[model samples]
Target: MEAALDAGADMVGLMFFPKSPRHVSLSQACKLADMARGKAEIVAVTVNMDLDGLSRINELVAPDTFQFHGSESPEACAAVKVMQGTKIMKAVAVSEKADLEEAQYYAIVADRILFDAKPPQGSDLPGGNGVSFDWTLLKDLDLKKPYMLSGGLNVANVAEAIRLSGARAVDVSSAVERERGVKDNDLIRAFIAAAKNA
Candidate 1:
């Protein structure tokens, strides 16, 4: 986290989904969040957590934003936003152009939208699958709410991905990992530098 901060990362995400390799418990999230609190925005990433669960996470993690990375509806996102008084980012699964339509509903309630590749069939996780959609698919998106592009971004291809998608911001996970669920400081630094320079 410190490495990413020093590399000029704007936000640091801590996952809460048990199924995800990157999942962090409440206690772990608290510690990580505190460390990154002043340096960068802390985001609590969850997958279809209920209101009670979200409230508990907000109290413990104290995140600046809640990223819903699942099949959560706009109403669900709105509820969390009103309940936590924190910003919400809804992750929309994109496999094709029609998939982008999901963002329209989330946009009405979410503060930001994250476009990620749809999980492959039979996959247990919703995101962080290390897959990417066609960047050209997002070339003409002109939504009212700001959006971030994610899914298979890396230091080598992020700039071109940004160029083709016209994305102002991007998210990376597997690309920065030395092994599954293990982040590499060098990769983090390189990715941040590449993104900022791009």
Candidate 2:
């Protein structure tokens, strides 16, 4: 979290899904959220958590945005926005052009959309699989809502990924890690620099 903030990240995501390797405890999230409060937009990334769980996270982290990375319906997303009064970002898993269509359903309820690679079959995790979809599938995307590109982004390919997909924002995970769940500061800096330069 500190590394990304120091690297001038516009937003920082704190995972709250236990199944994900990147998940953080409530206390850890609180500290990280506090650290990023004024420096960058703090996003709380969750799966299909219930309202009670969401409330707990909101009370502790007070994130500026809640990113839903699960099978949350448009109504569910709207409910969260109304109940929490925080911006919403809905992640759509893209494998083909047809998958991009899902973003339209969320456009009305979500403040932004995040296009991520579809999770591999048999994988328990929903994202951070180091898999990237065909970027050209988004060459003519028009969701109206601001959208971000994510999935398999690294310093080596981020610039091209941004160019190919015409993405104004992006997200990275495994690429900046020394190991599965551990982030490396230098890689974080390098990736941010590369993306910014692009």
Candidate 3:
């Protein structure tokens, strides 16, 4: 967490879903969030959790924003915002042009949108799958809410990815890892430097 903060990361993602390898327990996540409180925005990433579940997390983690990466409807996203009074970032899985349509639906409900690569069939995880979609698909994307690009991003290709997608922001996970769920300080620094320079 300190490494990411020192690298000048604007936001840090903390998963709440146990199914994800990156998942952190509520107490652990809250502790980390507290540590990064003023340094960086903490995002609580979740799947198809109910309002009660979300309420619990909200009370504990107090994230700056909530990122819905599951099959959450626009109403559900809106409901979460009303309930927690925190910003919401909706993740749309993109494998083809048609998938971009989902962003249109979420623009009305979310504060921001994240365009991530669609996970492989039967994959347990949603985002951070180390899979990338065709960047050209987002070449001319223009939406009411700003969107960030995610998936398969690293120091080597993040600049090209941003150039091709015209993305002002990007989210990376597996690409900077020394192993699954274990982040490498060197890779994190390299990625931040490369992205900023790009």
lDDT of 2 by residue, 1-198 (tens): 888999999999999989888999999999999999999999999999999999999887899999999999999999999999899999999999889878999998999999999999998888899999999888878888899999999999999999999999999999999999999999999999999999
Kindly report which residue stretches of model 3 are placed more than 4 angstroms away from their true locations once superposed.
none
Error of 1 at 7 (Å): 0.6
Best by lDDT: 2
TM-score of 1: 0.98
For candidate 3, list the clashing residue pairs, or say none.
Answer: none
Distance from true position, residue 61, model 3, in Å?
Answer: 1.2
lDDT, candidate 3, 18-119, per-residue tens: 888899999899889998999998999999988998999899889999999999999999999998999999999999999999899999999999999999
Worst 10 residues of 3 by lDDT: 138-147
Clashes of 3: 0
Q: In terms of lDDT, which candidate is stronger, 2 or 3?
A: 2
Query: 82, model 2: CA deviation in Å?
Result: 0.3
**Backbone collision count in every prediction?**
0, 0, 0
